[model samples]
Target: MLATPVVFIFGRRFFISAFRQLRHGKAGMDTLVALSTGVAYFYSVAVMLLPTFWAKKGLPGHLYFESAAVVIAFILLGKLLEMRAKGRTAADIKKLMGAQPATATVLVNDQPQIIAVRDIQVGDQLLVKPGEAIAVDGAILSGRPLINESMVTGEAIPSQKESGDSVYAGTINENTAFTMRADKVGRNTVMASIIRLVREAQGSKAPIEQLVDKIAARFVAGVLCIALLTFFIWWAFGGPAELSRGIIAVVTVLVIACPCALGLATPAALMVGIGRGATMGILIKDAAHLQKLAGVTDIVLDKTGTLTLGKPVVQEGLWLDDDRDINAGYPKSAARLLAAIERSSQHPLAEAITSYAISVYGKDYSKNNDIDFDHNANAASYINSVFLPGLGVEATLGNDVYYVGNARLMAEKNIVVNAGSEKDVSPEKPVDFLTPMRHDLTAITSFLQAHTTHTIVYFAQKSAKDNRGTLLSVMALADILKPDALLTLQRLGHQGIGLHMLTGDNEAAAALVASQTGINRYLAGQLPADKLAYIKTLQTQGKSVAMIGDGINDSAALAQADISIAMSKGSHVAMDVAGMTIVGDQLSKIADGILLSRLTGKTIRENLFWAFFYNLIGIPIAAGILYPFTGFMLNPMIAGAAMALSSICVLAASLRLRYRKLK
Candidate 1:
């Protein structure tokens, strides 16, 4: 028939591949189709050529060429659909690989020259012009520009980078040209690492898949044995008509017991689930993590960048000397001096002070003689500027030395603040002229206590002739929480997931953020080791822990948790180690991801159950076991169509995951 050529054209590869597998003694799902269809087609040709011989045995002498062709056609159709779905599942890796630039412009003998990205090496100086993607991870040698790192960090806002700050490949340089010294290239780049992670994850077999593979391996052999047994039973136990019935029973068992549905049970569901997560802005690094996410019982969140906006702003300030009212901003001259010192530092706290100072007093005080503030342009005039790590800034402003830091820095410098006309000063430092009257100490304490949740930065000054400094003023800075943080936490709690906040911030600030976000428990002032230890303890208690954070300090904890989540705007190290990255930095996506995981898991279990359940009941019926009681037998042609229907049903069940509501 004309249909034979069409079937052969599409199904030739399946037959050849299956034959090769059988000859090598490694039978797969293809082998079952090849054996059943090959027998049916060739036997039908024999019956058409020699009808007298089949008539002698009282056989039907009917040709079943169409049955064989239809089976191959149905199978080929299923394969085409499965292949398309598999490609969509791995599209996330393609999106990530596309981000890397193909070429880079490097400085050759101080002149810009274009070269392939692979040709660029470490220590090479590259130029990233405005709107151009960075070619490699490097440090800026010169030029200050705003770089859009959303490609890597998932943060929508462009971050400003000055000279000596680090820039990564795939990030766009905005509105400026910058020269950078490449530190990593090619496979060593962060983008390359992300691509590799996604590929490995997609290729990795989930734990359930391993179980299915084990069952499938033995399934084909069992089907062959059942078909042989069905043939022998019909010939040995039945009357003269059993000869033709025996032949039909053999083909029926093999056709009906096709392992296609069983083999596709896990992978089909996994492909759809992983692909859906990518589209929803949740990048699942691997299928293993997808399986792990649904089981997470406890979620640990970092405070700084995860719950609250990382940007700190000045809330309030008060001068130690009552010369200016506390409700008003710092003294104009002191604010100018503080801004100048802060402008020289790159700390977030320092940036807050500088912004506050510029708003309270103009950027340049000389523009208006009415105010005694100094210009920020003279910020570089200070000498011996040292940025004490985790403390504050120390710089010289004219003939006097100034210190802008926290209470701990003031104590370390031995700056006395007590209730006396002449405070008890350290003998090693000159502090005879300074005094902390009872009223002034009471006022400072009251103001600081009132803003217990704010980060208070002290501004102190001393004459160059003296080693000690007098406390001039204090500024309170606070980082506000994200708008959706409260609702996201409440949703997670309602789902029975325990919420715990782990932060490096002080207890008071952490407590305020926790209360506002509706999180009932937290561990403040926790280091990376402390977080890792807590996750380990939770795991020991049979709780699956998920840690969400966005800094280098969080990388270790992320690696330790059952599921690690990172914000889009968080540190590269944290995202790299995390199993899931929320592209929009929304906490609600975590809940959505968990919901999708549970739904996908349920679908896979249903697929697997139907696959096994169908074979368990279908195989015996096809073998003619019901013929003795009901006199009903599964025809070879009907068995082929039923087998194809089972596979289509499995595919349809898996596709349902694609439409499940994430919200």
Candidate 2:
């Protein structure tokens, strides 16, 4: 009688939930446990309260109070262990949330004031001292510092941040104090976005999870039917003691067939897998994306930032006049004109030229007294400058008109190379500079072909008489390829993944990076819409495509891909459209994410197989299927223990994923 209260106390929740499910005309795993234990406990109560009632049947009047109470105790213990294990799966998200600081140092009236992070508003000047976490996303205003972005991007190396550079929240400053005007505060920060994504991913279910849920719902009703059939069949065919034997078999079947393991099979593995991905800096946005990642057969990569540093630097420049050697310096008059035109353009090549000119020549022509000019300040005098998309910039300085762009721009303006009559050069002689312009263009072209990776920017001028343009100079620039690019491509290639490069650059530059990085297929001069079309084409071919990019141009394609992966350094729109974000901008992590997904898929399969196998085998044995062969029946207490063990085993198998090694 004392033990009966123990069962009611520990098993109260289960019985209440089972009653609710029964009222709604639905059955769950709790229903089986509640019914089996309730029947045993009430039957034992009847014997204890009225011994003469059971004595009439000659049923031995055995009290089963201990059996029912012990079964509920064991099941409750298993549930507690499972809950603890599930709690460990989300520890990574907790660690990520802990990285953000609660307070910030805001500059007010030129004095430092400590305030809560949530109180910070846009345009507030914040101070970030060395080793302190950045309070919000902002642009640096004063001191230069090395920031450790590993918390956000997963790359451990410290990145140098100076004036005008953007910094994110939750990142730490390394060696200098800096003040920044806050640009994004509160939930607008990247850290907040990552947290939201991780939580949603953990809660969302995959397609397989839906299938498992459907089976679990039906599984309970099916188990009850089998138990009823087993009892009836045995009562109709067995000997005089069949009444008691049939009742034991019915209770055993209900006790041993557990749907808890079936329901836990998919969710447990997904939780561990997503949490593990977070620790590695791979933010999976949804459980369905994890499934899609494993099926990716083709990958499209953006050229500029994805494969290279995206910062181009001038390598060399060629002067058109033979009398003026480029090493000596470009002719003062033309250098000023070229510099003024390039400074007006925002293209990467133009920026490289402007930077190179400022570095090689002084800021002012008269300040140094060497007659070399700094045309950056003189750019205001040139009026009506027009930017031609994809071509170059056109501008006028005094009586001369200048053009700075690729060779295609020169061709579009009808500027002819090698058209001048005079070629021989002398400082004293008036040699036609236009004729030597063709020589420089040819030399730059040959150099670019030999290098295969340099971007050439051409300079041209219109003749006083002809009005059509003549080539003046060519500047070659190149961006640095990432150190891990080649190895990442090689590994992906070895895994039988088809790699293709999509870029807005010309063929030569694109080919060079592709070849150097071991990517065999490529598409050059692709616009944003074109890239999106290409992704759709690949999908039509029955290939699941993963598009990796980090710019505004890649946003459309990223949204169109089955699996979209964005680099950490990429634009906001790209990250917003992508299904997964590679936090460190490490190309190698792409392969790691894919490999982890495959492993997670395997784990889910193993869990489901074990869950289904346990139920199928246990249900039959509990129904007394082995009684005739072994002359023995399964005990209700042993059946309850077996049911609890099955759920514990599934949880243990899924927990193994937290320790699996990733690439």
Candidate 3:
């Protein structure tokens, strides 16, 4: 009688939840637990209270108060262990949240004022001291600092930041203090986005989980039906102690069949896998994408900002009348003209040329004091300046028109590139300076075009008399490859994954990157639509393609691919469309993400197999199927222990994913 109050107080949750589920016309695992324990408790109570009534019917009148209490105790212990293990699965997310500082030093009226991180608003100037974590995402306004981004990017090296460079929240300032204007605050920060993505991914269910749900929904009801059948079969056929044997068989069947293991199989694995990924700087958006990553057969990569560093620099430049001498006066003059035209454009190549010109030639290259050749002054001299997308820029400089762009842009302007020949040159102009340098210019252009794989830009001058342009100089620009790009591609290639490159750059530039990275198939000069169409074509051939890109042009292809991966350093548009975001802009994380998915998938399968196999083999023995053959019957206490062990086994299998190395 003392144990009855303890059982009701501690075990009332199961009975109440089971009742709520039955009212909604559904039966779950709680229903089975409630019915089994309730039967044992009430039956034991009846026997203890009416000993004379039971003796009259010839029943043993055994009190099962200890059995009821023991079963509930084992189940509660199992639930407590499972909850603790589940909490560990989200440890990475908690670490990320902890990385965020609680307070920020904001600049109020040009004075440092410490305020709550939540109270920070956009455009607030915040001061970060050395060793302090960044409060929010923003651009540096004054100081240069070495920021440790390992918390966000998983890179051990601290990144050097300068004015106009972007800084994300959760990164620590390793060196001197810096003041920055906040652009993204609170939930809009990158750290918040990563945390949100990880939480959503862990909570979301995979496709295989849907099937498991359907099975678990009816599992309790089926177990109840089997338990009823076991009781009837055992009671009708037993030659001695029929009632006692029937009650034991029914309790064993109900206790041994566990639905909790089946329900936890997939989610447990997914939670640990995604949390592991987050720690490694691979943010998976959902469980479906995480599962899909394991089956990717092909990976498409973008050249700029993906395989390469995306920072284009001027590699070499050749002036028409200068004999391979960049320091010559004419070469400097030509570079100045190129900078004057390119400084107004925002293209990466254009910026490279402008910076090269300023660095090679002093900020003020012109020697004559009479001519004002400053950037702002030179920019104002050109009239009718227009930027042509996918080509270059055209501007009217005095009486002559100058074109600074790719070869295609030169072709559109009717500029004839005379290699070693002066066919399009005006007859009236001086040919004395061009005669000796014509062969040198041709050799230089040919060498640059044939030997070097750098992106070439043509600078030409359109004559007012002939209405045709003459090529003046050729500039070669190159985007450096990432340190791990080659090794990452090699690893993926060894795994039998087909590698393909798609870029809007020229064929020469594309060929260089492809050769360096060992990519056999590549398509150059591809626009955003072309990239999208290519992904579709590959999908039609029954290939699962993962598109990895880091630009606005790649947004369409990223959205269209089977799986989209974006670099953290890339544009927000690309990351927004990507299924996975690789922090630190590391190419090797792609392989890590895929490997983690495969391991997680394997773990989920193993867990599901164990859950199903345990119930399939345990329920039968509990139902007394082996009684006629082996003369063995499963005990109710042993069945309860087995049920608790099944859930623990499933959780242990899933937790193994946390320790397994992704590589």
- Which candidate tops TM-score? 1
**Which is better, 2 or 3, measured by TM-score?**
3
lDDT of 3: 0.74
588-613: candidate 3 lDDT, tens digit per residue: 99999999999998998899899889
**Residue pairs in collision within model 1:** 153-568
Candidate number that wins on lDDT, 2 or 3: 3
Provide the lDDT at 121 for model 3.
96
Candidate 2, overall lDDT? Answer: 0.72
Error of 2 at 565 (Å): 2.3
lDDT of all predictions: 0.74, 0.72, 0.74
**Residue range 1-663, candidate 1, lDDT tens digits:** 754674467667768878798788887667777777777777777888999988988666767677677777666654654454322334444556667888889898999999999999999999888789998888999987777764454333356687899888878886668799999998877667655544543444445446655675688778888988888889889865686788878877877786667656666777778788889999876565676788889999988879988778788876764345656654666777666677667454677888887776556543323334344345444445676644677887567677888787787775544312344544554443224545667777788888888778887876666566677777888987877888888889998999999887768878899888878889786755677788878989999899898865566677678788998888765776677889888888888999998988888789889988888998999899999999898877777778777878888998998888765
lDDT of 2 by residue, 401-496 (tens): 678876767776766554453344333443232234445556755766665466667777765555456676667778768778888888888988
- In candidate 2, which residue ranges exceed 4 Å CA deviation? 1-206, 213-222, 234-251, 310-434, 437-445, 448-474, 478-480, 503-536, 551-560, 626-637
Given candidate 3, what's the lDDT at residue 661? 78
TM for candidate 2 is 0.57
